[model samples]
Target: MNLLHANDRRGEYPASYYTASATPLAPFPMLKGQVETDICVVGAGYTGLSAALHLAEAGFRVVVLEAHRVGFGASGRNGGQVGSGQRLEQDQLEGMVGRTRARALWDMGEEAKTLVKDLIARHAMPVTFRPGIAHACYSQGEADHAKVMAEKLARDYDYDLVDPLPEGLIGSTAFKGGDIDRGAGHIHPLNYAIGLALAAVAAGVVIHERSEVHSISEGARQVVRTGEGQVVCDHVVLAGNGYLGRLEGRVAARVMPINNFIIATEPLGDLARTVLAEPVAACDTKFVVNYWRLSDDNRLLFGGGESYGYRFPDIVKTVRKPMLEIYPQLRDVKIDHAWGGTLAITMNRLPCFLHPRPGLWSVSGYSGHGVAMATLAGKLMAQAIGGQTGGFDLMASLPQARFPGGAALRWPLLVAAMTWYSLRDRLGL
Candidate 1:
């Protein structure tokens, strides 16, 4: 089976609210002949697109080759929750690395949010920059944990605005109470990626869609060969996340592509107020997180299903039960769109950026924090290629362990582990 096209038919981007609202762009012409550039970036998602934009702004002759259309991957089809910090909590990260480096990573997360906002304003992209991402907890214990985290971030980190919400105020059936992270917010992810492409192209970056990079060879210069043409450049950026295949074995092994699904219900109208009572993106604290928010048009967009195999489940109704378990009031809601996309997840829940070779670089495995992490990663990659490797070294210091089994066996192992986690979530463990 043509897995890519089969998954594409699985409804990841089939007539959703995002697709309906996006400002469609003319198709980018595919690469047809040999080209030379100072830098050749693969994948046109957020990371590749952002890196291209920054490199062009730095006056590098950059060429971006994409396997599919721009924003056609997870960058365009994500939950749109631009969260702060890494997927792992601050304390966990600090424990893995020293406090000094951990703090720097935290700071980068903040910078990523700023970069996104700046890009949005600079491009004048059509996106709803709404505020207030209230993280919901399943129990009072988690809420208490959030409070402690808030205090630590405020005192030691010189960061504030992460306020703990008392249980009395968190009347949602899904959560008791949690922290309101002011730094966190939501966006139209597709619009953001497309906007970055627009800005990148405007800054003179050449982007060729449907030009899949099939092979690469390294020497004084790197050769990126696509199906239709080849690109010879001084530097190469491997920004293809889960779909990148085995382009760079080290980075690819560090991150396994897992499929996460979302379903958009028909418009809720006044019922939305009864459900959330406000316009705030929310996610529970379970290992397999349940995240949901109201669309601009009031349809509830809930994302919380995982499949180990590349293909999504035959019936997406399996996701509805879990979604309703969180928001029981939505038991009768009609699901209009059910789709899934692959996300790169790592062992420690932290994104990994590696310089596998002297002239070749890769940054992937954002876990579930791609919205902000991937955006910043692209910036750091630009710096790395421009002879400033400080930021890259700092980010690359994050702990990384090989998946328990090799590529073929890793998925089954992860599935077994996640099954246990799902059971724990059900048992309130």
Candidate 2:
């Protein structure tokens, strides 16, 4: 099943808390007949929209094609944690690529975070940026590791935004200890995405909602075709992420799409203090991680649970089991919204940035760290397309191993491996 249409209506955002709260943009006209542009970007999520906006500001004619409304995919429905560092930590990065390149990667991660904040401020977008993300450790060993990582980041990188919490994260006894990173934070994810879309439009980028790309014919000029129309452009950027499907084989080989669910509770009012003493977001050390933060209206927006298939499971029930595990006090609270979104992951959990062919670029497999990295990916792509390739080249050089078993059997293989890891999480192994 096409994940774009598997669990959702055509051209409609999921009935998410984000959709209920934020204002939506007037729909852009669908692509009809033919159009031409300097760059044709598929998918209107963070990566596509950011790339379009940057390229447009640089005076390039850009067109963004979206299968649904803007922010309709994972970009709108995630846990809203704008985290620091790459998907893998600095130590692991150092071991994988040398210390010099690892430090460069760390610097790029910091740049990604700064890009998000700067974009919001520069555009004066309606999104609110809240600071602090607490890492909740479930065991003493995990807590000690957190402390060590924090110290290593400080000593090696000369960056100090983490503080160890030996007693545990505030407002929950579920964790043995943790650490808070003031440099990392959260935001209204959907609003942030919509804001980027609006900024892209303001920069003279044309966006077509409901313009799902079916295929791309590459040559001296690339042709991106949709059901209703096509775009003949100088460059093609495959920014579709999980919803990208089989548009490019190279991206599909390394990036596997997976489903994750999130639920939002009714406004907690005074009881909100009992869930999070401060306004910081929190994520735990579970194989299938549990991430959460209090919404502006005092509702707990918690995300957990996993589904390997294209079809989403009962989102509320799937996520509630883990939500209650963290905050049983919320047992009686009403769940206002439950939703699932597809995000792509790679074998090594690092993003897959590929220049599969000349004038063709694909960026995905953020491995659940896309909020910041995806945005930066777009900017880097735009820079590369404009003849500056330093940042883009560094990211593209990162190792991206293809999934075993190719397309046909990768799903079943991933299911088996993920089930084992999740079982270990349950057995505390």
Candidate 3:
């Protein structure tokens, strides 16, 4: 996949509302010469930068190489809803990994959310970090399921603040709400990623933007070769996610690249309150979740509607249709901007961490939950490298099955499969 070239906005920022309003930062020069470090990280997105920051804090020299600017990948251009747990349901997770291990994974998800907030506070990032994200459902049956799940979580896991919203409260003339999670929240993801990179650099990690790791040699010490330079290091980390090429065959085969898109509407001002009486981030339970939240500036940043193939539609039109379906009152609202990013997914919709070679590591395939999970995965890997093993091994031991077809045929196969599921979503299955 020509990932860098395929999604080119031509040095111009994506036509995203976030990009337009982003606070500017100084651009880093690309890697120009051969370099050496205690660890070399590929992909300067959340996972890579998080690993670099923690490893640097541990006094290990780290180098981060990116194909584009920081936040250029999915890390920068996401829907900005930071929620707990995996994309799959909690009961499904328990069924797959057993109760004890599933509970551990659930705890890890919570840790991921906390880690993001702590990182933001430490860097003083310019993002309106707020609490209370919700998952709204238009159907009463969905509401009932949400109540059961919330009760289960509270009873068994001692998790609190997961309250089910009755139809009267959330069910306006327009839409109904499902469940509220006080622990989940939203932030400007791009700002968070950029801030994290800045913090990593301040802590003595070298981050080279536009420095793609074209190839690598894995042995006792892994050498990551970029277009302009090489990073000779004791360990190599591939956190490239959907853009991870054939670097490690084992890791690459297990994860499939999936494209998801988001669009922002023109500022709704006070009218936005009419749609969502209380401003809370929300997602619907569907094969493709329709997620949206009020930006700090009050623009309704609605996200959902995915294209499984490495193909993107004219974003505004395709994404706006989905938004209108949920809130038809917004039919007259103008779409200000639209953008898309690719995320990696495994067969089980769980992330995979691997040690393909003794010193080579990769943590990716978060399905659609990469923002927080990626950060946590990076931190755990850092801990493992620093001689703390249990957490990282637990995460790594999670079952990860390869997609049915290899790269050449997987996209079409997934597109076909997801089309049927999306049909089911449309049919309210």
Best candidate, lDDT:
2
TM-score, candidate number 1 = 0.96
Q: RMSDs, each prediction?
A: 1.9, 1.0, 1.7
- For candidate 3, the C-alpha RMSD (Å) to the true structure equals 1.7
lDDT of 1 by residue, 33-121 (tens): 89999999998989999899989989899999987778877887779999987787789878888798788888988898888888888
For 354-379, candidate 2 gives per-residue lDDT tens digits of 99989998899899999999999999
In model 2, the runs with Cα more than 4 Å from the true position are: 166-169
Candidate 2 global TM-score: 0.99
Better of 2 and 3 by lDDT: 2
lDDT of all predictions: 0.83, 0.92, 0.82
For residues 175-270, write the lDDT of model 3, one tens digit per residue.
444788988888888888888888999999988887877889866677888778898899888889987867778987898877788888788887
Clashes of each: 0, 0, 0
How much lDDT does candidate 1 score?
Answer: 0.83
In angstroms, give how far residue 409 of model 2 lies from its true place: 0.6
